[model samples]
Target chain A: MKNIIQNKSKDLQNEIDNYLKCITDSSLLFFEGAREAYRGDYDDAENRYRDISELERRADEHLKAIQYKLYAYNIAPDSRADIFELLDGLDDIVDRAKKNIFQICVEKPVIPDCMKDDFIAITAASVDAVDILIQGVRSFFEDVNSLEGYIKNVYLYEKKADALEEKIKRSIFQSTVVEELARKFQLRYYVEKIAMLSDLAENLAKKMLMYKIKRII
Target chain B: MILKLFYLSSGLFMGWSLGANDAANIFGTAVGTKMVRFTTAAIISGVFILLGALLSGAGTTGTLGALGAIKALPGAFIVSLTAALTIMSMTKAGLPVSTSQAIVGSILGWNFFAGATTDYTVLYRIAGAWLFTPILAALFSVGLYFLFKAILENIKIHLFSLDWIIKLSLILAGAFGAYSLGMNNIANVVGVFMSVSPFVDIQVGDYFVLSSLQQLLFFGGASIAIGVITYSKNVMMTIGSGIYRLSPVTALIVVLSSSLVLFLFASENLQAGLIALGLPAIPLVPVSQSQGVVGAISGIGIAKGGGNINTRLLGKIVVGWLLTPLCAGILSYISLFIMQNVFLQKVFI
Candidate 1:
């Protein structure tokens, strides 16, 4: 019984372990780059963007390895396709985070005084959404019954991030903080970038739910 | 050794044709889909079939023996040659056929030529088995599929492990299927030689003995193995890339169920059990593996909700079922006539 348990959980464990590493790694690297940019350390932020690129590449490689191994090892064909698709969707989150950090570094978009806390808040909420999604993914493998709670949290933070994105956009357009429409558009683009991060997390959570249903059926 | 071999070569030829065609039934899906190489499949099947024929290809009487025995070596050779030719023709025509049916028909034709009595009771029983093989195969496959599906769904096994498990199951089932095919069908290949066997009991050790029938089966098995190694690739390639997209698991289930029916039909213990229960014993018949496989496949198709069932394929198979015995019988009769009238040989003792 113990041996069977170990074998059954082994693949799920690998999925969770690898997925969490990419999620955590991309999230941390992106945030660190954002912090350095906020502190006017463009060189450091640029370096971090390079790191995020490196991380995303590594994550993709890791995901491909897991995909091949899982397929080769013994997952049922029906389940195999779903897992590959799920991981593919999850990998999107890291890709988006890497792109967002790269956008900030290239544009060197100036952070205005009034929207500083809001930008930070937006980043935190996106991170939280992803964090919840990661947990949901973990709980799904650990105790599938308990996955709903983490999934709910993922949705909750996604909605929260969406609202924060709306507030930041409104403040940028309505307030005379920078005076140029182009500059305001730049701010909106960066704000939407952060919101899209949570969007990706929410998309991943939905895919996870899909895979769960597939498992059940 | 050489003269004896020449006499029984026809039987070995029939065995070769059987292995060439039936190799598709056991290893088609795996080889077709490129999961396993044709060479690998052939080698594995060959080894298992040889083992199966040597070990359990015993006591193949009751039905074929009752039909009529070719008591003369020349008559047995003629019958085997006729059967082998029929099978070769069918395979050449791209039809998967039952070598068992061919052998039976040939034996009956020889019975006619030799002026021996063909027992209707034995013919009726063999006919009945051929009739029910597909039905029984379908039923067994449906039952086993549901049982396996239930267990898998309940366990909700991780996907990777599930794949691993299915592949392993397929290998085991395929091996067993090949073994069972050899065990049950070896009779068709060499059963005609039983009465004509000149060899005495082969004493191996103080406790072991190889009978004449077993010795004939071993040679027949080697020819079958040779057929697998040399041929089987063309059929595999044709079927693999064809319209049939059956999963490995489905293939495994079908093979398992078909082999089970074949094994059950061949089992002396099971026949004895039936007799003990005061029921008619299952005839030790050389049942059609092709029919059994078709039946199992149909059963799975039905169980999987019936929409995917290929009506055209089923119809073709049903037609072939009717055609197989008739073609074999007529060919055997004509061949026997030529051998008797033209060659002027005594076909009976």
Candidate 2:
């Protein structure tokens, strides 16, 4: 009976590790895809978008499997709901990453050379926020005390993303880099969409803190 | 033979109530948190409790014998019956009661009625043990809580692996707690009948033998096991989830600490070892398992910075501690009087 529970727990742990890996893979893909779009490499950007979309699908499947096993095996019965919520929050990071990359591929916004670096910078910050958030989640499971540092880094990256996003929007609308007002609005929408990833990460970090507190015996 | 069985019924009833109520103190949090299944807890606790009773129940029973030594079967019956009745009534009134305390009071009543001198030294030792049980449990828990915390912080175990460890630990601790309960509290259920026990010694093999006292303990232990199997689930749930919500890890500490405390008081070998070392031996007397659990919980609460101590509940338990024995003693005295006079029974000889 003990071996059975240990084996089941090991299997569940592998599934969760795979799920988190999918999110990390998607974040890397998003970073690459946004860079491709900025560089006018539309083919590469499209391929990255397709890969992230597939990863998102796989992550969803993993989430479903994890949920089923959690209930079926009755692991951590007291913290089941909290565990599910934390995992669901992580899935959102990948979901947002997929949508961001897909939007970049479809809209094909023309970027000025001057503001291109700023846009990539925002993407990098958002990706950093998400990467740190994943690390925070892992720390939550392994070492709760170390999780606080990861959470703090996530907040820092999110703040950096927010600032870079503001800088880019201010440059786009205030400077005469783009002549069309509608194009500026489109660029700003994309900026906000990318920045939303960091915002999602920040929210999840707050929740992870609460979960950590509860998990502490 | 029928009359002898009839006289044993009250002791069986006391054992049943002990099983129903005290099993929760061992397995409540584990089952309540769903870390362990109720059936699993019941089986492990029942088996271990019976084994402990059969093997080590003589120590505390000896102490009770020293206290009063009821010589007649009918007298033992009345004492056990009054103790059981007092426990049931106190439980129904939702007061925290201890079978150990009740049985002691009942024995004292018997001592008074039979004109047998109460052994004041033995009585003081029993009272001292009751006071020490919870405090010792609390001290053990506080130390264990910090130790576990330090180990967890230093180790790099995965959350799932940690969960598995805690689940397994709870089971092991519950078993130890059940064993200690049987060794310590079985006396409360059947100790009064030791002088009047009907079983005779039996040799099963050239090397294996069972004494009459062992057989008596086995019967009492079986009654407790039946109570655990049949009626302890609701009480387990109430203790597990209702009183104070303990995390699985904290629950493990609580069980281990309380079990150690009970084992300390009940183990004759340990007492002998201490005596050999020229140290004072802990009295082998039954103590409240519920109080031990409560103390362990409080120790953890204090370890966590002492925010929610629930002093009101502690006050009520203290009140119950005082009132239960008094009620049992009074009831035992009255019941013995009627048994001797109206029923024409020889309560004492």
Candidate 3:
């Protein structure tokens, strides 16, 4: 019976890992789509953002599953609350990112000379952090040893996201025309969404670390 | 036995008012700030007040017993009932006043009516404490405001950087306020009963009891706690609406600050640490929770801009605080005079 319970929780963890992988892949596709849109490939960017939104929906379902289990078991009320809150925060990030892409498609923004590198860095960092998050939760559940290094990497990724958001904000301020400024603002908002995605990933990794500390998982 | 029952019932009523009104002081700021819903705030304050009373109510009972010559069971009952009624009536009028002042005033009235001389030194200390409460509170509020702001700004560090820190601070601060409220204010709810328990009696001469003072205090604390949980909601609502709005963080700060001051005053003996600092010995004067928090709020309002401080609300509070003792004293005097002249005389006749 104990083994059955353990296996069920492990299965849930695996589901989370799978969803996270989809998130990373969708993120990459969205970034590429964004690049294409910047280069006037509007249809492809729209498709990429649509795919990312669908991935976000899947992630949302996994989060709901985790929440439902936490509520069912009544294990640690505080921990459960934190997890649910973090999930909502994660969903918010994806929602914002998708919304920004749709707006960008509507505008057909003239890409700035400086913002291209910042936007690329934002996408790369966001994707990498999600990758790190999936690995952290997976290895932590599978074996405690796998999480030690990955958790630190998750922090590094979050910092990278923060840096990217800052760069994007600075680029937005430097844009001259109102239209360009507005487009820069949209890009900055998208970058911030991606940055918060890293924060959510970092939070999950921390939760996994705590569960291991208490030997509760 | 019937007379004792009357006082016991009154004590419970007082407790309920204390729970409803004073508990708000502990939690109002938090509720006002929208940190915790009103229902959650009420529950947290109510449960913890009871817990604190059950755990450390003895010291407060002792303070009440030592405050005056409340020896005879009958006299004790009268005093308790008088104080309780005074508190209830005052509370009903939308006044966020202290039951502490009401009790002290009623006790003095009881002494005058009985024509008994207790100790002058005790009375003097109490009166002095009462006089100094507002001044001390004002000073503390102004000083603590700047002090905390300085720490928050100058430290250049956030204490809540980690998630666990946020969770821990909330729980710790809430529990501390509840505990301190229980410790200091339990006596206000049940103190008169301590002197008039079956085991003790007022001899009109000394602070002697017929039985164990501790037992009576415990009963008073327990009964008052019950009252607060059951019927304090109306008073709580009155406070929430009447006083400045409270957010959860502000409520937490208010409760913590008031509870800390109350605990210091109620301690059995001054701590060596506090004494070494050359701070004056804190007298066991039951400070009003309303006064403590209002003072804090006024400090906050001043810091923001004194114009933001609602003069109308401030006026109401000031009127209530001034009138509580006077009204309680006069009402008790009239009630006791009637009891002694009309009712008691007829019964004896």
* Top candidate, metric TM-score: 2
**DockQ for all models:** 0.21, 0.58, 0.05
Tens digits of per-residue lDDT for model 1 on B43-139?
8889988877777776454356668777877778888888888877776776657788888878877777667888888888788888888889999
Q: Taking the tens digit of each residue's C-alpha lDDT, what string does model 3 give over B1-349?
A: 6755665666666776676667666655444333334565556666677666666666656666676656655555556677778777876786766788788777777777776665678767766665555545555666656665554334322211222232334446656776777767888767776655554444545774434445454555555555556655555555556545553334445555666677666665554456778876666657676767766676566765575565666677678767877777777666667867776621111
How well does candidate 3 match the true structure, expressed as C-alpha RMSD?
10.9
Tens-digit lDDT track of model 2 for B205-248 = 89978888988999999999989989999988987778757888
TM-score of chain A of 3: 0.71
Which window of 10 residues has the lowest lDDT sum in candidate 3 chain B? Answer: B156-165
Q: Each prediction's Cα RMSD?
A: 4.9, 1.8, 10.9
Candidate 1 lDDT over A1-217, as tens digits, reads 1221234537555655876687787887788788778767899988988887887787787787777765554344445677677667778888888888888888888888788888888898998898888778766655565677888999999999999999999999998887898999999999898899899889878888877765541
lDDT value for model 1: 0.77
CAPRI class of candidate 1:
incorrect
Q: What tens-digit string does per-residue lDDT give for candidate 3 at A1-217?
A: 1221222344444555665566566656766777787678899888888888788778778777777755553323334455455445556556655766776687776666556677777767876776776666555434444567998898898889888788677757765632555565666666676576677777766766675454321
Model 3 score (lDDT):
0.62
- Using all chains and alpha carbons, the TM-scores for the candidates as numbered come to 0.81, 0.96, 0.61
Greater TM-score among 1 and 2 belongs to 2
The C-alpha stretches of model 1 lying farther than 4 A from their native spots are A1-16, A28-54, A60-92, A110-179, A191-217, B1-4, B31-40, B92-94, B205-207, B233-243, B277-280, B343-349
Model 1 chain B worst lDDT window (10 residues): B155-164
What's model 1's TM-score? 0.81
- Predicted complex 2: DockQ: 0.58
Ten contiguous residues minimizing lDDT sum, candidate 3 chain A: A1-10
Give the winner by DockQ: 1 or 3.
Answer: 1
